[model samples]
Target: MAKIAFILLCHKDPDAIIKQAQSLTAVGDYMAIHFDASAPRAAFDRIRAALADNPNVTFAKKRIRCGWGEWSLVQATLHAVEAAAEAFPRATHFYMLSGDCMAIKSAEYAHEFLDRRDVDYIESFDYFQSDWIKTGWKKERLVYRHWFNERTQKRRFYATFELQKRLGLTREIPADLEVMIGSQWWCLRRRTIEWILDFCRQRPDVMRFFRTTWIPDETFFQTLVRHLVPEQEIESRTLTFLMFTDYGMPVAFYNDHYDLLLSQDFLFARKISPEARELKRRLGVLYAAEGARFRISNEGRSLHRFLAEKGRIGRRFAPRFWETESSLGRERELLIVVCKKWHVAKRLVQRVRQMTDIPCIDYLFNEESCALPDLGGIQSSVEKRHRHRRALVRMLFDYYESDRLLVCLDPSNLDLIEDFCRDRAVTRLLEVECQVSDVFLVGHAMRVGLAGDRTPRETLNRLLPTIRNDMVHESDRIRDAQFDNHLRLREIDPPETNARAIAAFLGVPGDTAETLAETDHLFAD
Candidate 1:
């Protein structure tokens, strides 16, 4: 029988942690917990009292303060692991979990999985060999020392890094150790844990060096385990599933995400929302059920890739409200197809689609009434759009992923156009201005609003020829004079010239221009 001990990390949420600790209890299993030293002693006392009846649970003798990307997190983790080892001398394995993590699979599944494998389960990759370090200074973390807290004192953190760069200050890794990076979570064999802990005990000087290194929690055990254990015995993957959004922000789980949690093959789901008692209760029910099984599926990795793909667009959004604007991805070449009419944009999108494989998204803001699920084609007003206009425009940009993308823009989307032209770094903004608006459509809208009856298809049926002829006649001069100030503007003066105009603006070859011109049937009688 495999004796697995869990080291649970907690900083706050005493009630939640107590429930989590209580749920994970088993007669044979041991849990060693460490409340963050910064949290109030009263809160810690409440949690300790709540689990006092459980003989399997223990708290660290000394707690440590944890800061994001700081060395203290590693210290705190090791402190708890040591406590677990002391409390359960017969423990054969150590699994590091946190208050925000929950076992998605059954305990039997985890025990069986561990029993089948003699090797350790952890994510470890060579610093230089892997592209795993998604963003920020990679090898620099090992080479230079970090003093300021990345989250709390960012200015000082970056300023110090810059100063170090200017001074050419560097550090050397010990000869025997090759640095590796991985997630803070891991499940290691008892002997492997002993070796890692023993190595830390022996290497006082090395420990001192790691204390100054950036985010050592990710590297300390990860690098040491790689050095202490042989290659075959150390699996370079974690049993715990973690998902990150743009810029490596970890996604938190809520009760609403129950389906997604059930789909993961991994033993545990991390960073649960503090208030997700219902989610925990539901998962807890499945966990204690008979005939529980460990499923193998690509959904975990697929979901990650899916979110990453979504993150590559101009914007990335999460359930958190702040991410709506904060998580914008790398900007790409943006071509704004401007028109007052939705049909004109639709026709241009069709022509553009015919010409190139580059993604051409249509009707970013549809002027015509749009049919939505459970509702008939409804017209949205300027006031309704203004409420969530930024999110609305940004979401469309986020849907299509490409190095260069073209999107049809309503003339009403001026704020969006202005925003794009302003703050974008690598993005090049271009515009195709369609002079396709006519007075006939304007009259039709008024008729619909006042008379409560208007047939656009039949009405436009008769006005097509007249609208085509008057597309850029003297009736439009005053309305069109102010377009010169737009970023990289190109014009479609007459209905017949849309194809050629778009081709010329995009710098397409002469032959392609002719092909595009053949698409003028988009404005046919």
Candidate 2:
């Protein structure tokens, strides 16, 4: 039988930590907790008194005031691990946890999962080779000494970094070791833990180097593990499930994520919001009831595929799966017509149809839909936006049996705009930005049911942000369009453009292109 010891690092919310400890105590595994010195002493006492009766729970004597991206955190972890080792000598593995973490599965399952694998489970990505750090420096962090805590002392932190960059000051990294980066949380074998502690004892200079390294907690053990452990025996991924935003911030899991969490088999999840009381209660019930609430999505069952998406985009933002690589839009030429408003897109399509023989259709996405397009086989469905969008493109071409087709879209339909703009078949794109005159603003507001007993100026003030955001999104898409080799894109904002390019794309004589330059009045009525 494999014995697992837990090392928990806690800084806040004693009640939650105590609850976690009670659950772990019931599991009969020894757990060592380290409370930050910065936290109230009353909190530590409350937690300690609550868990005093549990023989398996122990608190580290040395409390360090931990600041984010500071060396104190690693010190705190070291103390907790040491305490856990002394308290439970027969421990086979050490699993790291935080106050925010909760076990998703039973303790026996964790032990059995570890028992089946002789390999050490920890995320240790090559610092230079992999893009493990999303928002932080990679090489500079290891090479230069960090002087201040980034989160608390932002000014000094950046100033010192800039000074180091300007002065070309760098610290010497141990040439023998490879710089590895990973989540600070891990499940390590007893041998790996002993080796790391022993190596630190022998290599005091290496410890001294990392003491000043930026966010050493993330790299200290991760980089050191590779020095002793062979690559073949190390599983380079975490047992804990964590998701980060594009800005490299961990998203706090809440009640809304319960369905998503039931789908994953990861041992634990971290950074759970303390305010998520319902989520916490449901999770407790899930384990107590043996997962009566656990259910896979309909899409996952019916489509014979995992319905969940990746990152926060899938977990929180989207309701279901979106297959970008669906076999619908393969090898087809499409002309994208877009506007901020569906009314503008609809009218723009009408104008394009009159000007050219190319087939143009409207209402790709009209969320505040007043009148939906009655076109058969090409109407947009929210459930399958990509499928319906590709169908619309196909219908236009198949209806005319032409090589290319045109489809109109609203930029305000944020979900579909980017995908279509960068779609492989999108060889041509035209975006119309209707100039918001006083009359048009009022008319647009009234049309969209936004104008309610307000002056046109007030409507403009209220609606300017939406229009501005749409324009900004459109601008970003057009800027990104240049990178897409297949895309030939243009924006008719302020009714200005390169006449020759517009003339060529529309297949119209440049001399007769007055309509292209003065498009502000197109929706003024």
Candidate 3:
């Protein structure tokens, strides 16, 4: 069995870090902890005392005052790597992780995966061409020299950097080195770490150049690893799962994200907050079950079955079983028309399709009554027995890229919406609430008589309460205060204005004047 060294860089949440260390210790992995120098001494002391009895664990002697997007972050990592190498000389691999990260897979499984593969697992790509590089931001990070202040922990203004650039005071990166950027987390062979250290020592200029570069932690190691390792020897994927909200904020995993964590093939997950006590307890149980040293007795088997069932591991794993390989690539946006009122949903779909050329999926329950264009048969079957709604939605998400947009109409079913959000790790959803008065008109449109042959007004009166309840439930689920990117359609606006707003929200390109005009005419009736 290959010995793996874990280099954990932690600043806050010492208890969580200790728990992670303990879980790894249970599986026989050596850990080298490097707490940020700027962090409170109490936190460092607590972690050190917690791991004192563990012979396999060591601490980095030289700690750096690590700051985000600064050279200190890279410096801290280097110190941890060196310390880990010295402490566990025979260790085959070094896994870099943060304080908030927890191993989702058992140590034995991680070892098996790494031991079978000779390639280093590092997520790297061209800095200029990657999807993360938005126009001016890429140039600001790569081209300009950013002076990061340790005290304030912020970068200098772009204007100041530009002035320095004009004065030829900016540090120049090596022309020979191809800049690569990726996720900071990586798993590498001991030999790779040694090579990187040697390479840095040999070329001090490279280190100096990167010191003033923005987010050097993301670029420094990646650039060196890509340069040193053969393309075939690189897996180009990290073993850690990190979920970011629509506004690009890192999501802290809670009970809601437990199933999502289990569904992933990644070995580890990050940003498990302290508030997620239940999730932490569950992780403890899962880690014990999946640990290599865990003996599978009758009781153990039963506990394992319970954990697996609770996690929904079997069902969630199948969605991404086959990787998407279509030439169409991932759809940028998904327009889901989910309305209880079939006619209203159908109308919205037609207006949206007319307004924007973006592809849409019409999944209304009353498919027969949805008198809309087939449009490549995106319409799903109304027969609930034929397909599981949540499963089908997951399939669509898996098929498309992560950046796609989904527009669900009349999502009165809060439970279904919650399931979709939880399964997909969707922190933000665009909710369009179409509040129409005159329930009798909608009832007439549906052409469904009430129980006991009651009049339309009486039937609507009975149904209104249920409709109101559903709306309230949905509002509670998709509370504006809860999510940063939950965009609600402005119901007070004109039909054309609302149509344009929806298009803009989905990031639909081109002029919406014609579409809006058409929508106004359609809704005019």
Candidate 4:
């Protein structure tokens, strides 16, 4: 009989952790848990007491005070792995999981799946090839030295690091190391796990180097396994389902996500909070039914297909919102205003709203400038962060299938317009110009604390080159572009004239007099 050992890294919610652990318990299965050292002793004691009667359960003696983006997470996991190997030497496979993670499939099914596979199940991708990293700020984590203070759980930045990098300061990774990054969750054969342990013991220097890397937990094991295992022996599937938001934060699963969760064929789902008690109960029910070997229904298969297609479309096009095509059909015209300057965009939205009853939505990227909801929250797994803005615009287009659509592009965000046009052809493009000083003032205002003793005007002057660079890029990209409409903020006499011009561009009817008067007061400095 093949035996499996589970290594669980737990920090909070003792009851939930216990519940998840109990779900995976079976004869000949071993469980080794490492509770975070920072967590309350009482919580750890409670978990220990609950599992004390189980002969296969063991607690790691060496606990780490794990901090996010720190080496402690890796240390804790290693401790758990070591303990599991010691306690269950005969175990054939090791399944590494987090406290918040729950097994979606039954122990029997999971065992059957792994027992049939001779290869290790882990997700490993080249860091440079990953779309998410290429499209987001995660690349900085690889190139920069990020130091995390475990005591405070805060990132401490070195002011001179950027300068050092500019001056060709470099850190050399080992010649044999091929850096790989991916999901932290994995399942490995006992031999592979032991090999990893022995490799780490021999290469303490490699481990030490990883300690300085940002979020080493995500890359350390991934890089090691990819290097040690033969390419053909590795299965690139981590049987864990995780959803991330636009900001790279994990999306909290709720009861509403039950259908979607069920559609996934993964063995486990993660980051489930205690607040979603209903979802947990529902999952338990599904697990019981599936544990009995219940076949997926036709409806379930259809739903799965639908979800998979949606995911594919989302990755290629846009994030899915709950709104239907019929709901947005009432609007005859749709206007998308994209700008970095929130105040100006807000004013424009207000004027447009006053001018016409047709539904108008303003999407602003700068979080600090306005409270209006933006595309920043639409982080569907289908699209990378760099492609998120385009996905959002496409979603808007799908939702509001209006007769006419007007999109305004900010000079700084002209790249978005260019990408969007490339992906989906647009007949009309409108370019809006604002005073360089005004744009600089807004940028400076947002970075007040970082400016030290510099005045907003002085700071603007210093950042002029960067602003000019953006303008140059925008001009180059749009040089051959044909615009059906164009407006310069400073050139328009009376704010109403610009309002009327925008109304004409959007092909909507409105009382320009009232809109102009209202916007005049709004633009008054």
**lDDT winner:** 2
If both were scored by lDDT, which would come out higher, candidate 2 or candidate 3?
2
Give the lDDT ranking, best first: 2, 1, 3, 4
Candidate 3 worst ten-residue window by lDDT: 294-303
Please provide, for model 4 over 309-419, each residue's C-alpha lDDT reduced to its tens digit, 9 standing for 90 to 100. 422321243423532221223333334454445456667667666665544554433332322224456733323333455445555556555445444445545445544
Candidate 1 structure quality by residue, lDDT tens digits, 265-364: 5788887876777898887665455576543432444434533453243322323353245422355555666654456557756876877876775663
Q: Which stretches in model 4 have alpha-carbon errors above 4 Å?
A: 132-144, 149-155, 158-160, 163-168, 285-291, 294-525
Ranking of all predicted structures according to TM-score, beginning with the best and ending with the worst: 2, 1, 3, 4
Model 3, span 72-166: residue lDDT tens:
88888888888888889889999998878886666667778788989889988998778755435675676667776534643455566768778
- Model 1, residue 488: distance off in Å is 33
**lDDT value for candidate 1?**
0.67
lDDT to native, each model: 0.67, 0.68, 0.65, 0.64
Clashing pairs in 1: none
Return whichever of 1 and 3 wins on TM-score. Answer: 1
Residue 127 in model 4: lDDT: 73
lDDT of 2 by residue, 1-525 (tens): 677788999888998888887776565677899999999999999999989988889888799899888888888898998888888888898999998887666666666778998988888998888888765577888877887988888899889989998999977778898889898989999899889888888998898898888888889889988889999989988888777644557768887655545544577777678888888876654433331432322121211111122112321244224444643355766666666555656665576677667766566455424334445734546444445655545555666777667666665444565555556664556655555554554555555544433323432464556645545655565555463422222344333354454555555776544475444546543
TM-score of each: 0.59, 0.60, 0.57, 0.56
